[model samples]
Target: MNKTVNQKAWFLVLPVLLLVAFSAVIPLMTVVNYSVQDTFGNNQFFWAGLEWFEEMLNDDRMWGALGRQLMFSGIILLIQVPLGVFVALNMPKKGFWASFCLVFMSLPLLIPWNVVGTIWQVFGRVDIGLLGHTLAALGIEYNYTSDPFAAWVTIIVMDVWHWTSLVALLAYAGLQSIPDAYYQAAKIDQASRWKVFRFIELPKMMGVLMIAILLRFMDSFMIYTEPFVVTGGGPGSTTTLLSIDLVKMALGQFDLGPAAAFSLMYFLVILLISWVFYTVMINLDKREG
Candidate 1:
């Protein structure tokens, strides 16, 4: 006889479902409404019928911002993943030191994002900041406000400093889950460290690594506050990612139609890329299992 599945479990999740609908679905519907219509003063809206989307698609400024966003996400992934893995590998496996390291690694993740940005903002000032003063004292003319390259580097470095710990903690947890038997077997086989890592540790950590990649990619792709606080999309739009440009259009230029269209497109891009990452992770799990 086939056992009947419990239908009562749905009751437990009904509230959560309602909450999501209230918060996410409602806001998304509002954005969709805004995207498809044009608004004039006095809260008047008229049928626009994809006009704003077409305009946004044709805008070179939007495309440039997209390029910058992609580049930043790519660079962040490249740097953070490897560096985080290295830190995880080097951490003490178990001890007081291991506990200390764990706490230390978590500190950066605990700091508020806006606060982190504010700290960096002050920390990078040319005259008052330690970094800027030291660079200046060393005879290097480094000014983020006036220099595009410096601004980019500063933001990239600041992001790495703040988020690499997250990657490291995730990788470390993955490493901890590996059985000691694997390492012992590798040692018995006279395997070199590189060989063991390549054959064993890397595969074991692949699941968490994919997760780290997905989280970092999504976060970096949509990053706004930190860079905005640090650079204000400045040095002449050199650091102006898509989110920054969208805000500027929405609030600064008061182009609500275009901003709404831009937001929907941005949401779609993130959803599509995240789905890809999720698909890859699932396939990897199947292959490994």
Candidate 2:
């Protein structure tokens, strides 16, 4: 049977395709162009083929920033995933309380990124901020502006507070999708709580958990605004992640070629890591299935 295929859907999608090309593709092409070429005054450009990439690869500053970025992302994942799942497990399963909890959990995610940073920046002031004042009263030597450890702790805690709810909500949705029959079967089999979670709920939530992990990984890796506002990559660049370093190179120093190269490499690293994560998770899912 030869039936004519409907081609009308292409028309509807054309705008989005054009928009992506204009927004993402064009800018990427510009970056690539800038990466291999050097510019002087009056918009003059000359080929420097691979020089910038080589320099960036050998730069200690870039490596340090990358290490910090990786560490931050790793810490966020380690803390948020388990914490989010635990919160999800404890949340009300139904009724008005469930609705209320969902709304409350969503509140942190609603604030804009820069605004969240600003809120934390003010909230951590030693003289006036509630957190700082309370800590001071307790004889705690907490000062994010001067102490690297304190700065790191503040950013990590802020991130966990802001994003854990996202993981919880995703896990909750996965939980909601599970049929009651599974629980009934587990109950009939006299499965313990741990057994039920291990043999059923955890498996069911794996798909959403993978999603949560990837989303959190990418966001944390590229994180800029919040930490920048709060710490300004300060305490002697102890918190200077890749994005902040790149911005400093590009705009702060006007090193366009190196910055462009740095950005492209940054993009590639994220893409490569994300691919690995996706591949591993998909394989794990298949093995479990």
lDDT of 2 at 98: 100
Q: What lDDT is reached at residue 159 by model 1?
A: 95
Name the candidate that leads on TM-score: 1
What tens-digit string does per-residue lDDT give for candidate 1 at 1-289? 9999999988999999999999999999988998988887578889999999999999999899999999999998999999999999999999899999999999998988889889988899988999998999999888999999999999999999999999999999999999999999999999999999999999999999999999999999999999999999999999999999999998898878889999999999999999999999999999999
Q: What is the lDDT of residue 239 in candidate 2?
A: 97
Q: Indicate the residue-level lDDT of 262 in model 1.
A: 96
Q: Give the TM-score of candidate 2.
A: 0.94
Q: Write one digit per residue (lDDT tens) for candidate 2, span 1-289.
A: 9999999978999899999999999999999999999987467889999999999999999999999999999999999999999999999999999999999999999999999999999899899898988999999999999999999999999999899999999999999999999999999999999999999999999989999999999999999999999999999999999999999999998889999999999999999999998998899789878
Ten-residue region with minimum lDDT total, candidate 2? 37-46
The whole-model lDDT of each prediction reads 0.94, 0.96
> Residue 270, candidate 2: how far off, in angstroms?
0.9
